[model samples]
Structures are given as C-alpha cells and as structure tokens.
Target chain A: MSTTDNTESLVQLHNAGLREQGRWRVRGISLRVRAGEIVTLIGPNGSGKSTTAKLALGLLTPSEGRAERRPGLRVGYVPQALAIDAAMPMSVDRFMRLSNRLDENTLVEALESTGVANLRHEPVTALSGGQYQRVLIARAIAREPDLLVLDEPVQGVDLPGEAALYQLIADIRRERGCGVLMISHDLHVVMAATDQVVCLNGHVCCHGAPRAVAEDPAYQALYGKLSPALAVYTHHHDHEHLPDGSVRQIDNNASPGCGHDHG
Target chain B: MDDFFVRALLAAGGIALVAAPLGCFIVWRRMAYFGDTLAHSSLLGVALSLAADVPLIPAVFTVSLAVALTLVVLQRREWVSTDALLGLLSHASLAIGLVVFALLERPSAYLAEMLLGDILTVSQRDIVLIFSVALAVAVVLLLAWRPLIAMTVNHDLAEAEGQNPVLAHVLLVVMMAAVIAVAIQIVGVLLITAMLIIPAVTARRFAARPETMVLFAVGFAVLATQVGLWGSLQWDTPSGPSIVVASLAVFLVSLAVSRGRHA
Candidate 1:
C-alpha cells in the first residue's frame, strides 16, 4: 500500500483462480506486486497459499480469471522445499547454477550473501534443513531477478534462524529493490516486513496493509490468538539482527511505527 | 577384435554414452516407470516398422515420442493414478505390438532377436545410425542440461526463474525417446530400462555433484557394456540380458558399499 504509484508492477493477478478435478482450488484472488514492495500471502494448510504463488508466477494458469506479468520479467523463487532425489547427487554449487548461467563473482556473492558460501561444495542432500533453505535462497538471488517469489522460505529453521533468514530477505529487498511476493503460514514473522498481507482460505479472506489485515476480524477469526503476537512483534522490532550478529537499525521514521494505540 | 565385435562395441557404447546422462534425469524425476513405459512402447514401434516396411529407428523414435506425449496429455487429464496409467500403457502397447508381430507372420527367430537384442550382429550401418542419434541427443542434453536439472530439482522454481519447465520436460521426453530407439538394439525392449537406470543408481554412491554423477554413470555404463560383451563372448550368453546383469551387479555392489560406509 505504501508503494508509489509510479513504481512498475512486476506481476498482477486479476480475479485469478484455478480449478482442479471439478473443484476450485483458489478463486477470486487479485493482487499486485510493484517494484521494491513486499506482498505476503498467509493461510492455513491446503488454503492455496502455494497455489496463489504459482498463479502469480505464471507457473499455473488461472482457470477463470487472469494472471499477467511484465514482458521478460526475471523471477527468483525459493520453494517450500526441493524434494531432490536421493539417487541424484547435487552439490550446492551445482544447484546454484541450475536455472541460469551465473558468472563466478555473481555465484560466490549470492552464496556469501546467504551465508552459505562454505556449503558451495557440500552435497545438497547432506545439508541440514536450514542450510538447504538458505542455499535455495542463494540460488534464487544469484539470477538478480526483477521479482522474488518465496513460498514458505522459513519452513524448517529454528526461531532464531528464522528471524535471521527474514532479516536476510529484508536486506536482499533493500539492496536489490526487487518486488517480493511471499507465502507464509507464520503470520507473526512475516507481518513485520510485509507491506500487504493477503489472508487466504480458498479465496482472499481479508487483505490490506499488514497491520490492518492482522487486526481485521476475519483474519483474527481464521488465526485465533496469533493476531496479538503479530501486532506486538511489528510494534517492537524497529531494528533487525543480521546473521553475522550485527544489529541494523531500520528507518522507522520513514514508515509508521506503532504511532496508533493497539489497545 | 572381429569386425562384428567392433561394430557391436561402437553401437552399444554410443547408446550407453547418451543413455547414462538421460538416465540420471529419469532417476532423479522418479520416472523409471515412465522410461519402462517408453521402452515397452518401442515394441509397438518395431511392430509398426515391420508391418509398414519403414526404417526401424525412426519408427521406434516416433512411436516412443507419441507415447510420451500421450502420457503427458493423459496425466493432465487426471483420469487415473500415474503408476496405474503407466502400467496400463506399458502392457497394452507390448500386447498390441505382439499381436501386430503375429499378424505380420514374422518368424519367431526374428521376433526373438527384437525382444532380446542380437548385439553381436550389429552392422556398420547400425553403428553409424547409433552414433548419429547419440551425438545429436548428447548435444541437446548438454545445451538443455541446466534447465532440465532445474525442472528436476523443483518444477515451480524452474518455471518461476524463466527456465520454461514445460519446454525442458518436452526436451527430456524427446531425448528419452531418441535414446530408447537406439538403446533397443543393444539392450532390447525387455531390458532397456535396466540400461537407463542401473548405472545411474550405481553412480549415486560416489558422486557429490550432478555432473559427477553423470560422469560416473557413463563410466559404469561403458564398463557394464564391455564386461557384458566379454562375458557373452566367453559363455555364449545373450548380450542384452548380459549387459543388464552386469549393470545390476554394479548397482548391488554400490548399494553394499554405500551401506557399509554408513554402517
């Protein structure tokens, strides 16, 4: 909602929906991701968070409505998990180069940015859950995409590690100025960085600026007591803890920081 | 070596060189059954070739490609489970091929040769055709390697990153058909999947990277071919089945060694 009107929109889904096997998977979803903006989709199991992400990425065609993207848009995507076959041995370095041919500098810089440079030669199957997720992010960012779509990017990490990963994502957005469309079930972790939150369950339930969506009665009804934690976290986290144990102060003056009372 | 022996080596080695890398994709995608389905359909290609008086390799490639496309269309339609559909297609094609062979009134000796390859009788022309197709396949695989690997690692990620998962998938199917068409001469319809799977599985034990796995697979495949040919010369066993047995032996050894390392 804070994105300037002149910012280019990387992807847009207009009343988009997909039908599978005589049933609608997700319907009536409309959203836009503009350059340097972050939009998050949050929903419960089987609520079509991944479906919406796929629809936005044009990986899945909308059965009913429309999904559009800028011509020749470059996307960097981190899926929930890659189910790599045990029979296929793949090192992190090879995985990084899977989608595009990156120069040595770009490849190394991406890995270093994600703090997975040490894992370059490590077999992907041998990586722990968190390390693998970071490697996936590294692979995504290596392409220097115009849009970044991350589906459950923090699925396997511990709480502290999840925070660090989120910080890393924020940093990437800040540095690259690319539009981000993310899917998450962890409302509290995502709400702080998300400009807009679209809560979905087969359809968009409520969508607005993150704080407004978190406080919406529909979102509260769907998520129960989790809404309070989201509000509190967003209000308190004005500085981010980087992965290397450094603190970076977010520019709270540029954006509203709990200027209105929650109670 | 005798002229016939040399021709056999060239023909089988050419097929092995291409089959090994494509076989790794088949294994990584868990499409061994799909490969089996394509191999089974190659019998239909043979029957058609015999009945229509067309060239064998082209007919086999056409039929296998058709079958692969049909499988994709049927899978999208979602009529039955993938495994069940594969089984149905595999046996139906084989039975139809047998019926066609019977109707054509081919001698059982010729049919036997087709079913269990007569690699020892490989001619200069056959060797030439084998290598031609092999070279073309290898070139395409090299060019498409990154996209194919991206699709294998994760379909949505590949698509999101502008890799064109569908195009990569179609390329893979076409390459698999090409390999199957040539491989049938060395391994036969009954054992072609073994030629395409066993070496890749064997390679999985020692490889830490995808390309390394592919290289290891090619090495194992060539070793299996040579060992099987030597065994055939010594004991007068069938070459196709002998090659499969040799590769199976290698796979078993790898399985044991990997398990030993872990234990």
Candidate 2:
C-alpha cells in the first residue's frame, strides 16, 4: 500500500472468491499491488494463500467476486511446489528459454543475479532442492516482468539460505522497482522486509503493516506463539541476524529468536 | 512397397509428425488417463454415427470433444477424483457404445477390426482426414508451444506471466480429443494412450530439453511404426497392437538403461 507512487496497480483482487468442495477456498479478498513494494500473504495450511495467488494470476476464475490485472501486466512467478516433472531432464538454461525466448545474455544475467549462473548447464531435475529453487527463481527473474509473484519461494532451501533469498527478493525489488506479491509462512522474513502483510484463514483475517498484523489477535490465534519472536526481533537492535535468523539482544542479553517461527 | 504399405506408411508418418510433440505434453501433464478417456469415448461417437446414420469421423470427433468438455467441468467441481472420473467416463462411454452396437444388426465380422484397427485398409478419405487433423493440431501446437511449456512448469506462474494458462489448458484438451479421434483408427482406443505416452516416456531418457525430447519422441514413433510394420508383415499379426508393443518395448528398454546407470 505504501508504494512509491499513485501509479495504477499491477494486479488487483477485488473481493475475489473461489468456491469448490462445498466451501469457499478463498473469499471476499480484496488487494492491490503496486510497483516498488512487497506484499506478502501468510496463513496456516489451506487458509487459501495459494488459491488467492492463483486467482490473482488468473489461473482460476473467481466464483463470486472479481479479480483483475492491469492490461498487459508482465508478471514473473516463482511457485512453492517444484511443479516441473521430475522425470523430465532439463537444464537451467533450457528452463529459462522455455519460460521466455530470452537471448543467451539475458539468461546468463538472470542466473548471475540469482547466484546460480554457474549451474546454467546443470540438469534442473538433478540439482539439489536448494539449487533447483534458485534455478526457478532465476527463471522467473529472466523475464524482466513488471510484477513478481512468489509462492513459498524458500521451499527446498536451507534456513540460512531462506533469509538470503528474501534479501535477494528485496534486492530485486530495489533494482527493478517491480511490484512483488509473495506467500510465506515464515513470520521473520515477512516481518523484516515486507511493506504490508495479509493474514488469511479462508478469508482476510487481518491485513496492514507487518507490525500491526503481527500484533493482531487473529494472527496470534492462527499462529500461536508468533508475537514473541516478532518482539524478539524488534527488541534486538545491535545483533546481526544469524544464518538461522535468530538474533541476540545486547541490553537484554537473551537470544531473541528461538527459531520456532523460522520456516 | 505395395499400395497398402504406402498408405499405411503415410498414415503412420502423419500421426508421428503431429502426435510426438503433443504426446510430450500428455506425458508432462500426466494426462494419460484423460487422453484415454477421450479416446475410449470415440466409440460412443462411432455408436452415435451408426445409430443416426452419420459419418464416423465427425461423430467421433464431436463425442470425444464432448467427453473432454465434460471432464473439464467435472474437474472444476471435484465431485470425484481425477482418475476415478476418467475411469468412470472411459468405461461408461465404451459400455454405452458397445450396447448401442449390440442393438444394431450389422458388423458380425468387422467388429474385431473396429475394436483393434484396420490401418492397412484405410482409404484415401481416411488418410485425408488424418492428415488434416494432424495439420490443425500441429499449427495449434506451434502457436502455443511457449505458453504450453510455461503452463506445464507452473500454471499460476504462466497465468501471472500473461500467458493465459486456462486458454492453454482448454486448447490442450481440444487438441487431445482430436488426436484421440484420429489415432483411434491407427491404434485402437485401448492402445491410443500407449501411442501418446510411450514415445515421450522413452525420449525423456535421452534428451535434456523439452523440444529435443519431442524430436526424440518423433524418432521413436517412426521407429516403432517401421519395426511394427515389418514385424506384422513378416508374422501376419495385427498392425495396431504390433506398433503399441514395439513402442512399449522401447520404453521398457530405456527405463532399464536409465535405472541401471542411476542405480
């Protein structure tokens, strides 16, 4: 919401609802994504985070409400699930080309930005989980899309690498000034860099600044013992965020993060 | 070669040229059962044709397309599991078609050929229809190859990237129905899925990219047709089953080689 300007939103879900299996998977969700900002969706499993993302992507039609995107919105998506067939052999360079017919230089730059440039010729299926996730991120970044939507992008990544990836997302946002919409269960990463957070439980439970959502009771109820970690993060000013994302407070002399909220 | 052999080769060549690329998608999407369901329902088209005194190809294409649309609708509802839904429609249509055929008074001798295939006896009209469908499917694939690959990688990603994944999916199923309707004559309905999957599955082993895999699959199909035709000629066996068997044999060999090295 606190994006740089009053530019038209890249994508919007205006009271979107998708119903199936005798219930609404996601309902009455309204959101707007603008350039140069990050908006994250967080919730328990089946809270319809992915469903809402699918709606915004136009992969699924809204049953009741409307979902819309800016005309000719160029989007890049990084999915949580490794949706590509495991049996199929594909290299990172090939995967990038499959996404968009980018020139070799663009493909290399994408890989370089994601720190997987060396693995361009490596078989994507054979890459380790962490490596493959980075490869997927590279593929998404290759398109130079106006909006980047990531669903659980930290999947298959180590705890340390998770924060780095989030930081990289921040870097990408800064460099491209593209609107970013992401889904995450990790509150630490969500609290750190996101401009806004939407906590969902089959509907928008609470949404606003990360600090407000962190303090929200609905968010508290869904994610029990979440506030303490946020408090620890806030309380620790001088400590470096560890590879595991825990920080040690200077005045209080206590380890602020217990790693409970880390994804 | 004799006239019959030339006709068979032309039919097989047309099928191989178009089918191999589409088959790669069928394998990637794991829609083998869906393809089978459409192929099996072609018998319903035949039954409808016979009962109404209509043309077989048009009747079969219509019924197969109808079955595909029905599957898409049922899939949206999720009233039944996908495999269960496929099994239900597949057998139900086949049973209905058989019942319809039984009610008629003709085809005491041709029933066996119908159940399998009489590719050797295909007339010029049949070849024309086959080639036309192949050409149409090929053009659709050519225009759609990028979007199709993106959608296969991740539907939400593809949609967000402005690729229209829903349109891609609809187009895929329509093309699939057409393939089934045409291929049902070269291989029986029962063996149609075999033709769609076996070569793609085999190609995955030797090729490191999707386009290459498709080309390899085409090569495999051509080889299967050639070897099967030669074997059928030498042993006086059924042509369709021989082709299916030849392709299956190649797949099994690839699987063995892949496992032996990797294991």
Candidate 3:
C-alpha cells in the first residue's frame, strides 16, 4: 500500500475472515489502502477478489474479522455486468444526479472528465461497451467519492476500449486523487493504471508493485500453465505482433516460466 | 354504454397512471414476483381491516407495508434466497389472511369484492381514494426518482454514495403496497401482478429511457383498461381477466413491432 502524506488511510481490513454457506472461505486477509493510490487485485477465477471488494465497501460484514472503513468515506463501485435494461430510458445526465449531492457544474465536469459529456443526453441503454464503461465511471465520479472501486470494468470490451478505459481510470486518479481499487485479471491494464497490486487466490498470494509480484514465485506456480493467455504485462522484450492486433513481448531475462504480452 | 363498463374504464385509467412507473422498476429490478408478494399481503390487510372494522385502504396499506418491509429486511440478512423468501411470505400472508377471513363470521360480499374486484361496484369514495393515493405516489416518486433509479441499478453503489438503499427500497415497496391496495379493489390480486408487469415489459420494447418507458406503460395500461372494459361489456367477460388480456395483446403487438423495427 502506497501511503500519501495528505490523506489518511481510508480502509483497513484487519485479518478479515469471510465465510460462504457456513464454510470458512477466506482467512486472515489483512488489507490497507491509503488514500490516493490505485490498488488492483488480480486473481484467477473464484479467488475471492470480488468478495474482498464487497467487504471493503461494507456490503458484507466479515464472518470472523473486521473491515473498517474510515467514517463517512464515499465509495464509487462498478460491477462486472452492465446489466441495465436498455429499454428503460435513462440519460447519463439524469443518472449522475441520482446521488442528490453534486450540482450541475460538478456533474458536467465529471462527465467531461470521464469523456462522457457528449453522450450526456443519449440513452444509456444504447451506449456501446466503451461508452457504457465511460458512463459508469462518470456516475461514480459524480459522487466525488473518496475511493473508487471497480469490479472488472473492462471485462468484455475490445482491447482498444479496455486501453481507453484504463487511461480514463488513470486520468480520474490523477485528476481527483481518489483511492482506486480495481479487481481484474488483466495484468497489463492493472499494471498500467494501478500503483499497487494484490494478487489473490482465495487468499492474497502476494501484494506489492506490479512488476515485483508479476515475477513472484506464487504467481508463477499458479499461472505457469495459463501464462500465455492470462499474463497481462509479460516483461518479454521480444515484441512480436499477433494476428489479433496485439503485440506479444516475451521477457526471457526475468523468470523462466513467466513470459506474456500487453495486448 | 353501461354504467358498469364506464366505471371500470375510469378505475383502470387511474391504475394505469400509477402502476406504470411502479411496474418499470419492478421489471428492472426483477421484482415481478415482489408485486405478487405485496399484493398477496393485501389479504392480511383485508383480514385485519375486517377484524378491526378499520378503514380498508389504510389498513391494507399498513399491513402490506409490514410484509414488504419484512421481505426487504430478510433479503438484507441474506438468510435465504430472495425467491424463496418471497414465496414463503407470499403464501404465509395469503394463507393467514384466508384463515382470518374464514374465522370471522360476516357477509361474504366484502370478501368476494376484495377477492374478485367489482369495478362496477366502485363507489365515489373508491374513486377519491384512487385519486388521492395516485397523487401521493406520483409526487413522492417524482421527488425520489433519481435515488430510486440509482438504487435499482446497483444497491451497494447507491448505499456507498450515502443514499440509503434500504430506505429507497422501502419507499418503493410502500408505494407498491399503496398501488396494490388501490388496485386490488379494481383488478384483484390474481390479476394485479399482470397489470404491474405486462405494461412495463411491453413498454420496454419501445421505450429507450425510464421516463419514456413509464409514459408508454401508462398509455398501454390506459388503453388496456378502456378496451378491456369495453370488451367485458360487449362480450360478458370478467373485467379483470379482460384487462389482462388487453394488456397481453398490446404486449404481443409491441413485440412484433419491435421485431419488425429491428428487421
């Protein structure tokens, strides 16, 4: 966790324990996200990444531990599925006002910041994946939240859209200085946007800078077989363009079994 | 030409105006079953009203609100699946209401009227009740429109922004309870869920935003009410079923039209 001088620690998960269906699922998970740092949790499927996000947001109380969010800190969250009924006519402008706090100028600034200003009056249901992601980001920002948590914001988007959204998130962090926590499997995107990385596999396997943990032994052991498809920021300097319009850089100098691309 | 048909038409119009917006959220939140749960709880209200000799609508509203709140609270605890909770509460309330109704010795007319609404028997007081409740629901919803939408889109996100998801949810359930109480007197419980779901679902085919969807649902409901009343008068059918069928017909036509547009 990167600590900034100005902002206090917003979230402290002390040895947090969470249970599912009366069974102990996550044990002894401790997390601290200091303000103004973008922390991304990367894990394989069923690794409790989503649960950690929910717990931090106070959506679910830990079964045997504590998730203490600082008093009155606003959180902006974007879930995996955009599951909006497209037929329901809601414009981005109207949706942002739902928090009932932000004034018009702030709302417009948020929309502009997320690059969703031009799409303000358009029906959110008709937005493309990229535009929809942008709208959700704008919705979160309109609240002027102290922490922004996104669960797979770039799940189904094309590479370009995913890249754009990562850039948008980076911009938001820079502009607002809000602490961001993203749960993602996209190593490249998270590495590009986040300052700290927490690798979870039901429990946190490692937590530190993206590059260090990317080469960590635990990650290599778990993702060694699926390295080609899963590795986000493979440090391979041998750059080769693939058929799917993505370049693969296989880093041979670092670890033997750790080579991937940033497509 | 008959007075019965004329009265039923007016009653349907009033419900169409109110049920449209409520139905939109019900559809969006997958609370089609929630309407059923709330409508069934009206039986408890009916039983209590008779047992205590209380004014019917207010008593029904209170009891239904209790049941609705219970469902909301239970859902928050996540003790059981939402569907199971809804099913349990729905049948329990309905069974208890029936048992209470059976135990009380009285003229069966009130019970009959509540079970199968006598739109033709609608008194001036009933019209007044519909008008007043409709006004209250419309105003409250208009005021709380944005927050409600945000809550529906993602309850956790809504709560993160200091908007009380539970309160917003209760506000919706209470509004629904009021709508069901008013409508049960017009459409009856078995047919009431149809009134709430079909119009909104049909409108969803055409509407691109929440406001437009509600407007379309209201228009469809009004049409259904008018045509159903007319058909019942002309063909000697039950007014409630006739209205449902009219709404269903509109829905089918809308589906066809939407398909054609896409084609």
Candidate 4:
C-alpha cells in the first residue's frame, strides 16, 4: 500500500480479514485515512465495503488481521441501514447533543452548515428523507470527528436532496479538514465528491486517482455494465458542488457543465 | 387511603417509575419480547427459591441476570433468531420452574403468589429492594444517557463515534432484567411485560423527543398506576391486570390526542 502524505493519518486498517456467515470472507484489505482527505470506496453490493467500514470502526473484529485506531482519534460514521426507530421521537438538537462534549454554537453551526438549522426544534421523525440524512450529517459533524465515514449517504434520497447533501459534505470537509471515507455505489456522486477512489470486489481491486481508477480495465470489468446511467458517470470529473452552488474542477477529464444531462 | 390501598399504590408506583424508561428502550430496540422472556424466567427463580428455601428477590434477580446474559450471548452469536430464542427461553424456563414447583417434596401455596401477584402481601423489604433497583437503574441510565441514545438510535454509527455498542446493548438488557425481577413479585410475569411496554408505546405518540418521550412514558405509567390501583380498590379486581388495562386506556387516549393535534 502507498503511504499517505499526511502524517496525521488517524486510522489504519492492516491486512484486515472480515468474516461473514462464520467464514473468513474478505481478506488482505488495508486502508490508510489521512487527517484531511476525502477517500471514497466504490464497490458492488456484497463486495464487503460495509464490512470494511465496520472493521475500521472496531464494530467488527477481523478474523485474521488487525484494525489500529489512533488513541483519542474521534470518528463519525453514517451507516447504510440507519437502525433508528422513526416512531420514537427525537429532535435535531437532541440528536446533535448525543455527541461527546459539543458546544451549542458548534451544534448550531453544524446544523447551519448542513442547511438544516430550521430543523433544530422539529422532531427528527418529521423530517423528509433528505432532511433526515442532512440532520444525521449535521449531528456527525457536531462531534468534530477527526475522521468521518459515510456509507451510501445519498441512498433513498431524491436527486435534489442528494446534491444538497453533497454540497454540505464538501463545505464541512473544506472547513474542518476532517478525513472522509465514504462508501458509495453511486459512481456519479462518488466521482464528483471524492479525491481518492478505492475499488473493491471482495478485495482491493484498485485505489488511486478517481479518473485513473474509473478507467482501469479491472474497475470497468467489475462495475462496468452494472448500470448504463452509472457508466456515463465513470468518465466524469470530481469536485461535487460547493454550498454557494458553485462546482470546482478536480481534474481536466470532464468539462464544467458536463453534468447538465443529470439536470 | 387504607393501608392495603397504600401498599398497592406504592407497588404500582415502583413498577411505573422503573418500567417506563426500561419499556421505552425495549420498544425502541425491538427487544419487547426479550423483556417478557426475562420476566418469564423469574419463575425459575421462584422454583429455585422454594427448592433451596431462599428469599425471592435475590433469587429472582440472580436468575434474571443469568438469563439476560444468556440472551445477550445467544443474540450476539446469532445462535437463533431473536424472537425464536426469546420464545424458547421463555417457555423453557417457565416450564422448568412449574415442573420443579410441582415436584417439590414440601410444596407451598406460594406458586399462586408468584404467578399472579398479591400486592397486599408485599413486605417493606420488597418495597426497599424495588426502590433500590429502580434508583440504581435510573442513575446508571442517566450517567450513560448520551451514549445510550446514540447506541439505540444507530448502533453502527454510535460504535464509530467511540460509543461501545456491545457494552451499551448489554447494559440495557441487564437493566431490563433488573426491572423485570424487581417488578415480578408485584405485577407477575404475564403483566410485567405490559408495565415495560405500554407507557413507552403510548408516549411515542404524545412526544417528539427522547427526553419528552421518557417524560411522557413515566407520566403515563404513573397515571396508569394510580388509576389502576383506584379501580382495583373500587371494583375488587386484580391489580396487575387492572394496571395493564389502565395503561391500554392511556395509550389509546394518547393516540387520539396526537391524531387530533395532527388533524
């Protein structure tokens, strides 16, 4: 594995081997998350991406390898299945306060940053799916974690909402410089938002610049024809969107207005 | 009120105070039957107490904790589906307790006392034990309130955020068992689950935050307890079943009120 340039790589997964159904399932995967970089993992369903995230967080012990987390390194994560009871009432402020030692101003700022400050007093269950995800992201950022990981963050959200969330994430990452590792099946958004790409098909197929990895023969072979619309995004550039509705350029691969088709 | 009425009321109060938060979490975590399973397992404690000529509270608590630990271990291992495991343990424990009770060389009339509670028979020591357990559970819950909310809302996210989900889950189950053991002598196994479920279920409709829901649950439980005790006094009815009915009534009222507000 290549060494990350940042000295404060807060999280390291060393040859992690995850087991499923009582078998040593996914093996020999390693990851290095720097203190202030966005690294996105893209993989097909059942490719063990979620398992990898769990292992990183110490939610699951590796069957054959180890997960080393820095002492006092805080992490914030959003999982694919949210495991929350919608019927059980909770407000945005209360949810945000679940973090360790968050100040009220920081909470408000996090909410404002996510464009959901108005939801502070509202029952979280009352929020739209998009609003819920945004609030969740806001709650995560309120903790000011050194590493933030999101699993399919935009799944089950509408297109406009997804865009709004992407913008919110970019703002937080730029402002806080927290390391981000997101798992996404949506190649378009993943490509648009992330700096580094890690492709997995039960193993680390490739990890490098998004454009280079997207164009790799191995990546195309694994997730190539999975969806035709996604194939359109494989050749796209990164930079997602800013909170100001501006899109920046990450690479020279695609033109600025190339996402016009999505609109 | 008369001495009998006071004793019954105090017994009801204990159940309400303890079971309200315990029930809410059980409902939230979908561990409703697990609470029932623990309550049912207290019959084994009763049998063991009779067999060994021991006091009921200590015996019940020990057995309930053991059962709770067993449930957590089995659930963690995925040895059986949660519902199936709970059901199997519930019936098995109750059956063993009943069989052992019947085969006792010197059987007493305490079997009915254990099955259908006689609140009038509750000693001062029982009251002390109940209150002590309630206080301990409340203090522990309050201290771990933030992490508990985070863990129950989203285990994976909570785990990533440096809240240990395993410990949180175990603590919660053990607390539920404690509640069950303490309340079993006053409410009985059949109705103990009601005390742990009804108020929380009702509260969800009336409140939109965890703190508010807990308040609503406790408020509803206390109300049910008072009303049920009064109704039992006037109608010469069983306290436990009367309390369950009162809780049901409160739930329906809350549902109607919440619907009316929405409308």
TM-score of each: 0.89, 0.86, 0.79, 0.89
Chain B TM-scores of the candidates: 0.95, 0.93, 0.92, 0.94
Across B1-263, the per-residue lDDT of candidate 3 in tens digits comes to 66655666777798789888899888888888888888888988989998999988898889989998888788878888999999999999999998999899767877766776666777777888888888999998988887788788777767766777777888898899998988887777677888888999888767656778888999998898888777777786667787889899999988898899899
lDDT of 4 by residue, A74-118 (tens): 888777777457766877777887757778799998888778898
- In terms of lDDT, the best-performing candidate is 1
TM-score of chain B of 2: 0.93
Full-model lDDT for every candidate: 0.83, 0.78, 0.77, 0.77
> lDDT by residue for model 2 over A163-221, one digit each (tens)?
88888888888888898999997555656677767788899887765655665667777
Error of 1 at A65 (Å): 2.2
**In model 4, what lDDT does residue B194 have?**
84
- Which is the winner by DockQ between candidate 1 and candidate 3? 1
Report the CA-based lDDT of candidate 1 relative to the real structure.
0.83
Q: Worst 10-residue stretch by lDDT in candidate 2 chain A?
A: A250-259
Q: Worst lDDT window (10 residues) for model 3 chain B?
A: B1-10
Q: Which scores greater on lDDT, model 1 or model 3?
A: 1
Separate DockQ for every predicted complex:
0.76, 0.62, 0.44, 0.66
**Between the candidate structures 1 and 2, which one is better when assessed by lDDT?**
1
DockQ of 2: 0.62
Write model 1 residue lDDT over A1-263, tens digit each, in one string: 33756678899999999999889999999888988888899887899999999998888899999999999999998887577877778888888888778899999998997788998998888888988888888888888988989988877778887888788887778888999999988566775677767889899988766656655677777766445665455435422312222211222221343232221
Writing each residue's lDDT as its tens digit, candidate 2 over B164-197 gives 7778999998888877777766677677778878
